[model samples]
Target chain A: MPKVGMEPIRRAALVQATIDEIGASGSLDVTVSQIAKRAGMSSALAHHYFGGKEQIFLAAMRHTLAVYAAEVRGALGMADSPRTRIEAIVRAGFGTTNFRREVVSAWLNFYVLAQTSGEAGRLLNVYQRRLHANLLYNLRPLVGDKAEEVAQRIGGLIDGIYLREALGTKTTNGSKATAMVLAALDLELGQGK
Target chain B: MPKVGMEPIRRAALVQATIDEIGASGSLDVTVSQIAKRAGMSSALAHHYFGGKEQIFLAAMRHTLAVYAAEVRGALGMADSPRTRIEAIVRAGFGTTNFRREVVSAWLNFYVLAQTSGEAGRLLNVYQRRLHANLLYNLRPLVGDKAEEVAQRIGGLIDGIYLREALGTKTTNGSKATAMVLAALDLELGQGK
Candidate 1:
């Protein structure tokens, strides 16, 4: 029999391993065996846990999203104003843990996966809706009626920066990306006034 | 001889077929036979022309980019001012031909392909550079020293809008997408003044 209460630990290791593997490959063209090896476990065990490669990838993304949500919640908790709250949300997006090469690669691949996978599509919709809601919620106080439009632009900018960074065409680090979005925020606020 | 002046025509059909195939499936997980059959040609002949699926996809993107460049050039020909030139560029991106659901899907897949394919990466880099150059050239008179930064933000915004639209999270059509980018352009210009 297996050790009791070990499922969560093994699952966490597999999720991290999946992200590392996808990052190294820069695409979804990875194998279950490779991920299993990276996690220091057997393929059979990995399959027993996650069912298949797709599930493993989905699980990794879930973990990544959860981490990102935690970061945003933590940052938002300390923000004193509506503008700062927006800033906190933008910074959380480009935070170190969320903006790593592997994490970004996973995001790009996930976007692609959402194209064909229904489950992925639903998950992505949830993320997009949550992001839009968060931006709109804070932006309401500042932009008032223009909050929806401004939120869409900010959300689009964040996603766009993430997409560009994943391509690695430019050496835009987290802080640089954060600054760019913040500048956009300033422009929106200025225009609204 | 097989036929006179048929090479270019055959290649065009194959490229269009590739785009349609990728768009229909929404990923690169497609087969050469499927593309060939859709193009109304045999897989053997398709291989004779493009060598493989990857080459066929590269050709499809080349055609897409060429069409986009032509659209931009055509629009710029009638543009009366620098701001109008910027508007022309933004409008061309979200124009009907370039912003079709199939074409956007192809673009998203191509971005994913760039991660693992050197040629795709180079092609994407060329597209990115040309976009930056075009934006900077026109933005110079308007923003002066801040042209590069403004251009970068505009480029990122364009990309972000495309990414969001591809996911189909919101019902943002081409005109709507174009309007969003133009608004960002306006904000940047206003802030630079």
Candidate 2:
């Protein structure tokens, strides 16, 4: 439940804080008290804004999907031709941007939780499948007859980079991971890293 | 502390039982009394096998890693060409072997526990980093000049699929993923379901 007057701003702020909390570390269960303290508001106010932690988590995760969808759309703007657009779309997953750190952190944390045994994991899996379907639909023309396969491949590639960065155990950086996949596609990308 | 009759086989048996217990879902901590019950032996027999659950867990995790490492090596043997070997090696992480299932479950559980802020998490992180680094070293020859970049790509791909499959949500089988990747590599693969 939201106060009718402050709904948009309050909701945005809650989701933003959620992303910041998860991004600063990993997405653990952030308590009502912790979120309230961080927001400079009462726990009751936080609850009123987002209902509860689950609602807040879902909002933050969905907010990230929206952000990336917009970026992918914008990146699609970088080139008029389909081949170049596909390259831009692939690069979008790896390029340094303001959202890069937070996105990668959120991305890794998302998949980590997705591996667990429960509702949270199932929700994440559903979201990813739907998201990839949309991406495949978007890239269908660019990939010609093999759009579905290409979409999964690209999703896996983006997922692979997010996994590496989140695991923080891999020896190479985001750019390196991006370059190899691009090279494999023979998409004529310059050495990014 | 082991009893007088403690033997390596007995110790291995105890660890194997612990692995199944953990795999099937249960609290890992046990009195030697419980291990004896699980093993259908006298309490003294459990005492003879090993010191306790901690030892059992350590050995289980080590066994998991060793098994995965061996599977990886075997998968790499199935192909003659560099590209073929790389594809096979990637499949190793998503293989159909019994070892793949057990090792994935063990590693996934360990990884989740590792995310918590504690000694267990740190230990898992350090050990996995070493293993991932060693895995990358094996890909050096196939990658040639772009070894580091290629390693990052391939390593991330392998772990990404493992993470998804371990969850048993996104990927129920590896064939589709394998085909998608093989297609991306320009290798002709059988149709995916």
List, in order, the clash count of every candidate structure. 0, 0
lDDT of 2: 0.59
- Top DockQ: which candidate number? 1
Report the C-alpha displacement of residue A165, candidate 1, in angstroms.
0.2
Clashing pairs in 2: none
TM-score of each: 0.96, 0.68
Best by TM-score: 1
Worst 10 residues of 2 chain A by lDDT: A184-193
Report clash pairs, candidate 1: none
Candidate 1 residue-wise lDDT, A1-193, digit = tens: 6679988988999999988998889888888889889999999989999888789988988887788889999999999999899899999999998898878998898898899889889888888888899999999999799999889889988999999999997879999999988988888888421
**Where does model 2 sit among the CAPRI classes?**
acceptable
Leading candidate by lDDT: 1
Model 2 agreement with the true structure over A97-190: per-residue lDDT tens digits: 5235556666655554544435556667665676576567666765565666566666666666665565455444556656666764443121
**Can you tell me the DockQ of model 2?**
0.27
